[model samples]
Target: MLHALAEQNTPEVRKQARRYAEQRIPLLRGACVPVSKQTPRDLVDDAITDIFLGDGDPWDPNQCDLLTHLRGAILKRTWLEIRHRKLVRYSPFDLAEGDVETVLARERPHASRGDISPIVFASMIELVATELRKIETRDGPAQVILECWQVGFVERREVMLLTGLDDETYKLARERILLRKKYLPPRLVAIVEDLLDRSA
Candidate 1:
């Protein structure tokens, strides 16, 4: 089928490819974290456009099936979108900014140019540690929230599959987590808010 898609430069071929792409939509839904700037449908549209364009077909009879290839493509696009947003959100990483590199170079004068500066790395670690500490509460809702945000268990059904919780239990845990956030420290709440925003 993919061979036909690759060979035929016709409208029918393109339509068929779009149809095939649509079939894999369910696999992408909740499989990837949501992009703040775009809907999942938009990302799916981008994936289909990639297929219709010259990006690799990714189908291999000997290696894997069509849905698997499409799933990988969807995931790839998700990460690409997130990284692009991250660059925009953290513009200091832009090499075009004058004196930024000089400051970093001065701070890490002994480090090789390829290595990430210790200052930047340490800040990232601090952010992660702070957030993790807040979420490591005695109640188990933190685990649920972290699993959903960090481990790609974005859907309640998916979390249920891994934790073996019933639908009602999962729903209650999610609600409890949200309610608990109200009482958390402002800084911790801000971090959790950002995570929620990014994963939306």
Candidate 2:
């Protein structure tokens, strides 16, 4: 089909072909975290490496290369970079921090479009909610909230995946999210906690 599109020189068809190409295993792995913690996101990242590059070491900068690294098994295709000394928007690593203030302090900038639709936000919230379940069952409710505040609203992966951004678009969108912390305040995490409690 892609060959047919290229041979026919249909720009519209080529665009769809690009979408098809992007939807391969890497993107799918890039989209979702595993349903298990013993699973680890780095293993997923390494699996993405194995799938895309046929090697397993995503954490090694010298041995493996990609545009970004998710920093472990849970974050196969996601990663973070310092937008500035004052800001960082790497979702996977952002959540990896041990302190809630550290995670919450790393706020995403605001864009008019960052106001994600309720259905989409609900879905992302559910994802977080599910992860929270694992954490809470293993730890305790306060620990869960602490973890929530740590990586709360500045979750770049949720924003990035929902937007399905290309590299340039991701740059613009992430930078905008970093600059507009007021729009992406850490407080929104509290709402997620309430949701979890209600469900419990």
Candidate 3:
């Protein structure tokens, strides 16, 4: 099964594999202490051990590197009692003001001259803004966006769309996509629409 998954090249297959890995890899929370018979408890514990301790043979090497790392981390990570520090709270809108064009240009030099598509950069900005909004509303922490980026969507395009790109880009969207609005905060609009769409 691991070998098959490792060799999987299709988008559909890899997407399914990503989803399976995320759903299957969960922390062992509450355990049923088997008092009468240690068999069931032992079996469950060993399975957990196999997953956390052993080399990730069940994970696809190419597609499941993150999964493998997470598994190893669960077992091998040392407990740290470092003092917690407050997160840098800034104007959520400040992220939008940070020279997006210059930043994108600096980070992706190929993006200039329509080489990398301006729409794609816009989509990323919108996505980041969406996460910032979550922090503003107390709906969830800003960290959730990073977490979702890590484990939820398999494809980068899928993530952009999930963040309300709708089409390949906001400009491609039929109606006045809030994401494409010049004056309005694209990230905030995307966040509201994304939440509303989910509820609907």
Q: All candidates' lDDT scores?
A: 0.48, 0.35, 0.35
Runs off by more than 4 Å, candidate 3: 1-15, 18-53, 56-98, 110-200
Q: What TM-score does structure 2 among the candidates reach?
A: 0.23
- Residue pairs in candidate 3 whose N, alpha carbon or C atoms collide under 3 angstroms: none
Global lDDT for candidate 1? 0.48
lDDT of 2 at 115: 25
Tens-place lDDT digits, model 1, residues 122-182: 3434544454556446657547556665756655556787777778777876776566435
Q: Against the hidden reference, what TM-scores do the models get?
A: 0.34, 0.23, 0.21
Candidate 2 residue 51 C-alpha distance from true site, Å:
7.8
lDDT of 2 by residue, 1-200 (tens): 22322244345433443333332322222223212222233333344445345354434444422222322322322332111311331343223534433333343222122122223233444444444444334333234333444563333454445445455665554444334434333455543343333323
Ranked by lDDT, top first: 1, 2, 3
Q: How many Å off is the CA of 21 in candidate 1?
A: 19
